[model samples]
Target chain A: MMENEVDGLDKRKAYILATVVYEYIATGEPVGSQALTQKYNLGVSSATVRNEMADLEAGGYLEQPHTSAGRVPSDAGYRTYVDALMSPEELGADERRRIRDEMRDARAQLDEIVEQSSRLLGRLAGNLAFVTKPQSDTQSFRYVQLIWIAERSGIAIIVTSLGVASQSLFELRNDLSPDDLTRLSNALNATFAGRLLRDCDDRSLTALTKSCGFGDDMAAAVRAAFIGARTQEQPGISASGAQHLLDQPEFRDVRKLRSILRILEEQRTLYDLVADAFDSPTASVKIGHELGSEELADLSLVTVPYRFGERAVGMLSILGPRRMPYARLLALASGTAETLSERLHDVEVK
Target chain B: MMENEVDGLDKRKAYILATVVYEYIATGEPVGSQALTQKYNLGVSSATVRNEMADLEAGGYLEQPHTSAGRVPSDAGYRTYVDALMSPEELGADERRRIRDEMRDARAQLDEIVEQSSRLLGRLAGNLAFVTKPQSDTQSFRYVQLIWIAERSGIAIIVTSLGVASQSLFELRNDLSPDDLTRLSNALNATFAGRLLRDCDDRSLTALTKSCGFGDDMAAAVRAAFIGARTQEQPGISASGAQHLLDQPEFRDVRKLRSILRILEEQRTLYDLVADAFDSPTASVKIGHELGSEELADLSLVTVPYRFGERAVGMLSILGPRRMPYARLLALASGTAETLSERLHDVEVK
Candidate 1:
């Protein structure tokens, strides 16, 4: 009974701290005892709330920005709220509908999909967004063909079972009839189709080359084309809406905005962050102060890993101010991740 | 004359302070008074150096991390050193040759060159490197050709007079004969050649479409293809050697690395930074504490813009700990920029 009572007190203290932070985040101003008493039905008087607020301030979660003004949530206060008080809100129907509509017939390609995802997330959340395509090894080969188009132009098309197709163009040095190229294409596809190119070692490529009975140069060219295709299968990072950072109060300093924009243009930074999220599928949120750089401590990041079929492929996320709508942002991030995985699976299944 | 003497004294003080910072950066430790006196020939004794260090500390430029430790340059000290005293040294011939070789053949295409430049800068300087591709409108029209490869595939090849090639693949649904596709390709290319796409308005596209005698569906498809191509050409951002940040003492906090990575991932952040360099081709440096963000005040960024022919195509830069070798880094950045531009012009002239 005594332990239960102590637990209740702790919970109550936590609730008060959370309330103060939440209020401050909404107003962009400090929260005071009278305002807290009037705005929230905490069943506490102004005097009681004031005493508690003082204790919270002393505990380092709340800060008096000035002696005359009320208390504002410190970085610590924001951290506590994000970790404990923020609830996961379900994605609204309209949001889900918009995402689905946007993704419909997005039959472009992996690169297009990643680029669109970034723009969509950025637009939806009014924050920076990033997406990378699924790794190529995970995309099993469905079919392959070679066709001679012009007298000197030849095209190689490889379609993954996942509905993704990659094509390359090479100039023919010698005259090869279209029918001969078709026959060679059939021979190659018969030998390699339905097998994972990623599973094919160098020996496998060599073996297939030999079985196809083509000139060594043509075989080498085909092998080069395959390798090139695989290199792009790892998916590239695409991001958008970085200008949103300028809209936030934290970035009022033009120099700060410039530094941030400089950072964003370096896509490797986004690639690393998104790649890190793949280790864990659950939506992750990083807050200011925790980010280690005092400049970034005022910002927040919410990210989730996306999947290709049963395996995780890459990550997608939103970057916004620390005072971002966490519940909505979390739901949006997770929902988008789920939808991306589902669409990718459908492609593979089809 | 009295005022000039006082100014000379201030300059001496500034020079002594800069020497201390330079030595600390070179040695990666707090600089001792004896070492400062012995190394720079400032004509001061150990006792005088100690007195100056004390004054510098009092002025908030230097600090002792611990009681028996020598003095280290604080963020303020580094800022003062960078702004007032640091004149980054010139690159040696060998260094220039090496940087030029690294940038060789990297400008074959805008996107490829940007990626290569970022990685090469990172590798050469041992710092995080960044580059952003020119805006699409800034690029002149390359020759455009569409080659039909198979039943469903075609390749769009665009070769700029500047030797940059942009390629994209298109998949066809309704069958079109190779001759007919070739005619269509020729027709479209003839209509759009030698003009900037950005200069074409909606009515122009419609007029071009009608004048080319393209069917409604084919015209729509071509428009979509053009728009899709433009989307990919939005802008390119690249960075390499992010792992280098881990080796910096300032980023000892893993959380700080995470935030920096997050900031770096946003290409818009960097695009905004480098775009400013095009305003002037001269080398520019943003030092620690000088950056607007209190969070980023501990780091420094050195950037130089590279030209394509007579026009600037992009900016290249390195990000590192504030205690960087500014002279070497500046030379590396500027040398790489000059090399990239010169080689690109060479390729064009060839």
Candidate 2:
């Protein structure tokens, strides 16, 4: 009846707990002993099943909403089910083909690829799906180019080793000619190439600019551009199918819906949530209150880091009500991340 | 209850129709004549209110869900109410100050400003909020720069007159030295500057590149860069607060939730929905079935075009259930768009 007793459940008890979780997820209702015995063909008598249900409720793995009603899995029960009895659901051929086709059609850019992944996951999982851009801090500098576009303004284009490009416009107190701009660009590439952008400090930039034999004004402009490049905003989170959460009966209460919606509005919260999943080498599941937000106490998130080359740069996730199909959603998250990573690998090569 | 007689409603009929719509919107229940008379101090008896309600129903502005129940506003009724009876809900001074502060702090880049506007509108209106990047097709080229990053790769930086910068990487069939890149960059800026990027056709690009007196390989690379710049993906749609839709009783049905979620997943659909509102000088309201998608038949959208300088290039919108407070949402959309437009103008000038 305590938290430490989760591992003490025998094989049959584990099977019963898993069945209860699965049935409640599918039917959005409590599971009774009679229904479990009748529908699952457990080879046990109704009385035996009832006794096990009582034990589960006592063990903190299940709860009965009413004295006479059936049992539902507690968060602890879901966690145990996910860790022990669950088998990753295999995707059907049509689903795989749909995912491949959508990804192939979206092979043009990083942004398009991430968006397509989010849409596909949301549709397949019937839940909110999100994909983050490969964090720039995790990427190494591939090239830097400064082009003087006006007398006092220039555009700086920074390309990461992952093939993502970003541009920013900088204004100068003094103008630089085309040759000066080219020299500055070359100096920047020489100093920062193959290094993580976040590791670029102002001191190194100033030293490099000074070493390039530039006057103070030109060096200052170069320093501003380099600093601007390093501190650019992180690649944002792209989310889709949020409306799918409304389909859950738990969200029927307006207050609950509002609280959850407010959490989703904070981009940083979502980014951190998925970013934490990168520490795990495979699919990671945070059930209900484990998500660290009281507002999300009724929800669960299943996430996997989608990689590019050897590094985990971004993550894909499926968020839903706690009574979600863990096996199926985890499988989907794993499969989609693998496919997306392969596609991104191809993009990097091209 | 025909559509043509909407304008013929007398003062008393307008008052009663407006009262019914307002009461239904606030309470999410049918408005009975007795309840309207008791709650609204309309200087009319229950019998007179009942007679007016019957006439409104006959004229198609009101509907009775059942034979004996009270009345609700039909689509036509809501439209009439928006056009004539409702006074725009002005934002209080504190709300105005909050929006202004948020915009002022978000003035660094077009993307950030648009995102801040979306978050602000979503929070204030308590609905799904979206803002689009200024469409490239609507923007003229301010500058174009081609910079060689590696032996076979280069980045093309395109700066629109609105001060938004975009970058794309292109593969080179032949290597270009610094002089060649500079010449190509100058030629591109000379040929396409001040012209709408959408007007940069392949034929024009080929002609311009050939006229630049470069070798065919070099000309082809230049042409590729120009065409790539022209076809760069449009600034994307940023959406937030989609979870708010679940708070509406109308979206309590799983089917409705799924349909709306599917629409929100399609970025092009959202872009087109708000893009249509650009023709209006101020806020535009699309109620219920007028949104052009059967999936969105139960939703309402309030949108206003956020401009860059004098040209309307992007839109801001609030998406919610049809029972939303149209006046307040419209006013919020208008105020936010105006503030965003001014902030973007300041960025462009700098």
Candidate 3:
């Protein structure tokens, strides 16, 4: 090992590069070799550290913005640090309790949970925070109930198997008396209860209508409500502390800010992005170059999937400068997901 | 006129600058003085054009990214062009009709219209797009109706004075027979129909309970539904085509992209932005520096308020890179808002 130390400098070079990148991410500034040795106690002299930094630059992990400037992590360097050097610390009990308390106050509404989760994340990360509610497809339908509210108005209430509820209103043409309406309601429940709505096809609709013995007008109304219930499938998405993005140096350009604001206004794209993050179960880190958008290549996303009653249903993540503390962000994201899922399920059980 | 042109260098300069900006917007590149003179036939020599370009840069409206490169519009330059010099061409009949057709297909659903409007703005600007539905507070509640669906389930339908409808559901303690439920529904309509629900205070709640002649369990159920209906009151926001921002030059950095994506997920921020845009009646422009976020100073938002049957209910806008053709984007945003309102009103009328 001692013989190879001088001749093969690969391990020493890797250590110095890793140390510099770690210090840069922690401080959000350029890192010099002297600082790296001092901070990490690498047991190497400043000259050796400088030599390794130069070699790391040649290997594409570290970069010098100017001839005299300290070294900074290139995208490659950050990638290597994220992949090999970082280890996430466990979330402290106080932080976990705080997350649980915040989520508890949000009530059972999915939108509220999403909104609070984002806010909690933004506060925790001190960067931009984003969280998305479970997508409609991910939720199981518990039951669909239709009720007549007025002479011309009817309501459809859909309960998901996961305890989320949604409702929509439609107009009806029937002038049925209360007796007739009561009979129809009973008949509909008997046929439709305990059935998965997505599996309810045209045959099911027809069977529901015929068995209920509802008039054509009532039957048409039921079909319309059924269809409306199916398509009301959107989930809520929330972000917090986006203003904090402006506090970062990378967004100093007014043009860059405008582009970002415009991008933020498109929630559908964001919804898709967050949902895609959940496709991986464990904590996943998507850094610059991995996001597949040239505009997004300078950022890092830390995402972790969350469960609803043991089923992985959605995700929570943070999007920030690529130099973000990946180990901490990853830990925070994972802890948030696990705690949120557990808290939400607990609320439902109660 | 000739004397005015020669003496009024400011006006001519503005014209020449507007020309250069327009040409550059059409082709995402810097505008050289020679190209401006040759392509625009500015009746000036290339040398004179170069001198003017230098003056424009000095005025902070243009910049040279590299020493030998042609000039691009700085954020300030785009601001001046948007506010003072540029005159958007009127929408042709075909473009107007295309916008009308887009709104015509949205049917009677206001939610669908706002969603489609954002997409339309995106297609028009080739950038980010946003649309916000009317705030629930602005509208008065017209009716609340309850219908019994099963032994434990019932649906609550609410219609506002503005003709929009929403629904909710609740569980009941006692199984009110369908006949009794019908009586309760009728009793609710008799007392609450055509009255502003916001005007109905807790005093009215007591009055309603006394007047409905309901049993204790049934009264509790009705009150629950009433509170649910009156308390649910946030407007919806829909947006699309945010991914288009990725194609812009300013967000090419991965850090910028991540921060922007994070901000876009914040619904409250987006809702606030779009709501403020609707506070104006005509085409609204939120330029760099005006947008409150320094990160957004490189962006511009062109928005206009839209109406639902003569009632100003929402706003729709497009988000573009700061160097975008503001004149064209503003015109497109105006046309989109105007056409959407007209077509939606037509649907309402039908």
Model 3, B127-164: lDDT tens per residue? 87877776554555655556555676665555565445
For model 1, the superposed segments whose C-alpha errors exceed 4 Å read A1-109, A112-132, A135-227, A230-338, A344-350, B1-14, B27-35, B45-88, B92-117, B143-181, B194-203, B215-224, B231-234, B253-258, B338-350
lDDT of each: 0.68, 0.79, 0.68
Candidate 1 lDDT over residue span A1-350, tens digit each: 11222222365667777778778767767788899889999897988888888887888878897897898877777776776665658888988988977976465455556676777787778787777677676667655556455566565656665545555556666677766666776666667666766864556766776666656656765776576557663366677776566556665544454445445555656565556566785778777765545656667788888887677777887877777887788787777877787776544523
The CAPRI classification for model 1 reads as: incorrect
Docking class of 2: acceptable
Write candidate 1's Cα lDDT for B211-271 as tens digits. Answer: 7665565555566555544555437677777766656766655445545656675666656
- For model 2, what is the error of residue A12's alpha carbon versus the real structure, in angstroms, after optimal superposition? 3.4
Indicate whether candidate 1 or candidate 2 has the larger lDDT: 2
Candidate 1 residue B319 C-alpha distance from true site, Å: 1.5
What is the per-residue lDDT of model 2 for residues B170-251, given as tens digits with 9 covering 90 to 100?
6767766766777878888887788887887767877777787656665566556555555656457778777777777787
Q: Give the lowest summed-lDDT range of ten residues in model 3 chain B.
A: B1-10
Error of 2 at A211 (Å): 1.3
Candidate 2 regions with alpha-carbon error over 4 angstroms: A1-6, A41-43, A88-98, A215-234, A247-256, B1-6, B38-44, B88-95, B215-235
Per-residue CA lDDT of candidate 3, range A12-104, in tens?
766676678778777877888777767788887888888878888887887898987899888878776777665657889998888888778
- Candidates in descending DockQ order: 2, 3, 1
